[model samples]
Target: MKKYFRSGEIFIWFTGMGLGLSLIMITGLLFLIVVNGKDYFWASELVQITRTDGSKQLGEIVKEEPIPNLNLPDSLWNKGLMRMQMKIGNRDLYGFDFQWIDEREIKNTDLPKFASTIERIEFGNFYGFVKEILVDGDVKVKGEEEIAKKIGSYLDITSSIRNEIKDIEKSKIGKINYNIESLRLEIKKIEFRDKNSVKNKNEIARLESEIAKENRKYEMLKMKVDSLNLLASRYAVYCEDANGRGKTIPMINIVRVYQPNNMSFLEKLGFTLTKIREFIFDDPRESNTEGGVFPAIFGTVMMVLLMSIFTVPFGVLAALYLREYAKQGPLVRTVRIAVNNLAGVPSIVFGVFGLGFFIYFIGGTIDQLFFPERLPSPTWGTGGILWASLTLALLTMPVVIVATEEALTQIPRGMREAALALGATKWQVVRRVILPAATPGILTGLILAMARAAGEVAPLMITGVVKLAPSLPFDSYFPFFHLDRKFMHLGFHIYDVGFQSPNIEAAMPMVYTTTLLLILIVVLLNITAMIIRANLRKKYKSATF
Candidate 1:
């Protein structure tokens, strides 16, 4: 024990135990999030259709019966239909329906144990007029036979037409193949002769002429194929109509519902993973069926990119000035103190400053200069992508500056002295020698800044974040990116779903999943930055002082 104490192994053991405990705590938090949140990632089906107008209800499509499940104790089930309601935007939304059926309140109650199970549930748009009934009962579903018959007819007609087109395509392909074989024989004969021979030239020219003729035939066949493809796409889309009518049926205005099993953590985690995959790859807009997270993902990436672009150069330069050029004086001391103090400032304070200065003063003037008609509604003056990025950059500036300066300080003074002694220019020395050695430190700062900026919700909430973005920042349009637009962020999504949502039961899963997603994104960004830093360190290891 005395030897171990003298060698400081006891300190090492204690430190290691503390670090291990911290890691376990972090892992436990992540595990809880993964298990709780993954369910809401799946696209839920629309079951109950609630109409707008505060009037009659439209019919509900009960895909599956509701399974008897309860998470609460029996005391909570004594009251009648208890519902949680909330005001979202301009609408009053009703969430899960909690029923309290007491045996003492009712007489001769014989509730069936083997009732139909509800596989999934969704609430449709309450903003549209729904004329049908919207309640779940033990009656058989209507419109099956008529819809099936119409669908069968449409499929039969389209199939026959598609088959005929395919046969014609096959015939054209066969002809093209035969011509290719003939051309190959001519090429083989030409190859057998000497390159300088007149016989080889004659054979090559003849084969070329035949190939040109075949090309013309191929072009004609391709034109036919294009026309047939257009027809096939139209036919396929038409056949997908649930009612089998070609009339454009705008999707039933409905919110998605999923009948979740009270499954274990592992099953829920698997389900969540599947949902995330669907959200990423599947284009739900094709049928206007389900919403995906693509826009949100795009916005998050674009915002981070914009923030990094603005912050990195400015932050690095600021650090360079303070660390290298600026003499240590009262001004320098004051600046250092201010920079350190800035790091402790509440992020929301920066949000307000950004709103007033960048959004109002600078952006307002620009909007007035260019867009006179849009004076009141400031284009870049109001909450926007550019302003949000700028705000986050400013908020995270202190971290970058402090980190970079510390990195610059770590370089031995001898290195700089050697550069100056060798008659190298100051700019050249900094660019070639100092910057290379400091790359790792700069990247560490960048990763920290990125992590902080990505996780921040308050500043973005007031700046430019939206619950549902109208469009992504980037698209294949003029200007490519719309800077003057609000965007959805994973962090904000979590807040909106958890705190603001009326349906706690429904939103809980989404909250956890979005939180997990945000964590994953930050981790990935840090990992990428670390990899680049490591590569730079390897490349310039000899430059270290």
Candidate 2:
């Protein structure tokens, strides 16, 4: 045993075991997330459940489990009965999306082939049977066959109308409003510069004329939208719930209606894929409980890229100064130690500092100097993508600096001396030899920094991340990338959906899906960085040696 201990074989075994355990845990976690998230998109058969009390319940059986601390009479508890959780998603009628049903109470159940699941604009999903399709306030289709045939046409019309409305509101009307706001700001600027000058007055007059023209155009668009809405409102679908309660839902409000029980495996698979696509591409709605997270994905990528842009150069420069230029002394050692310690600081502290220094001080100064006309409203003097990126850049700078310094140190002193002896200046040696050799290490630091920044939610929440951003940072506006705009983030989106949602059960699937997406994104980024690093290492290895 003493010989084995001295040989360090036990320590090696322990280290290997620990690493293996870590890999297993990580793989298990990823498997769990995939299993839970992927099924959320698949269409499950609707079941009509009949209880002992003669009450009817309908929904997809989402989950079942043995009751924890089973509360039952002694005789009943002995049976070890399990409980079933049903997704009775008629939120508008039931006021909840889920329900817990005791197994004993469920006397009978059957998969209802005619049962339909309606995806709505608000109040979550509605599970019911199609009773009638009313066009122009008359029951045109009553039977299931007739309703199914005309339902597709009605849905197509509604979809077209919805697209038109979206275009008018988001594109045409939005542009007009943006132009009007710009004109207002310009007039304000003119008034601030010269309150009563002829040039100021003429500029203001011209802006007002432009605003009036835009407003007229906006009104015409609004009128057309109202006409489309009226046409859409005329078509309605009446549905009857499992409890025999009837509700009339407008065609415009119903996103989709599907008979899940009747669907073939291929049909279900296609529907699942379609839903997954929508989740990836669509904008989030229903307070982020429903729809896609495209904005969050966009914001996260944009912020990380911006942070990299800010952090890389400064970190590299600082490391170069410390490693190559600074004299070896207690002060330099202390500075290095401080930089190392900075990595341990709480991320939220950096957020507070960013809020105070970047937003309040620097941004406020910029606003006062350049955008005085927009005073009290605060353009830059608020949480925004720019500040958030800068904040994260500051937070991750130490990592880069340390990695770069280590890389610089690894480059042999003989190489530096050789370069100097060959009539190369210090700058030339560093730019040509040292930096090229250190590219792989620099990228390693960048990968680490990006992984950290992408997953960080606490720092982002106070900096510039919001539950929902009205518009993307990039747009058709001049100076297209709006660095001053607030943005969404996947990390914050997970936190919000997991902890802050009104419907925990409804949001749980979304939380898992978003988590999986974030993991995939981080992995993709790291893989890309790793590829670059590997290429750099291969290219420079011979030169370094």
lDDT, residue 193, model 2: 92
Off by over 4 Å in 1: 1-9, 41-95, 98-274, 281-290
What's the CA error at residue 444 for candidate 2, in Å?
Answer: 0.3
Candidate number with greatest lDDT: 2
TM values, all candidates: 0.63, 0.98
Which portions of model 2 show Cα errors greater than 4 Å?
none
Candidate 2 lDDT tens digits, 1-545: 99999999999999999999999999999999987776569888899999999999999887898875558776666676889989999888989999999998999999987899999889988998999999888998899877766798889999999989998899889898899999899989988899698877888899889999998998899899999999999999999899899999998998888898888999999999899898989999889989999999999999999999999999999999998899999999999999999999999999999999999999999999999999999999999999999999999999999999888878988889999999999999999999999999999899999999999988899999999999999999999999999999999999999999999888888999999999999999999999999999999898653
Can you write out model 1's per-residue Cα lDDT over 39-89, one digit (the tens) per residue? 345322222222233222111221223223373357755344322221111
Looking at model 2, residue 280 earns an lDDT score of 88
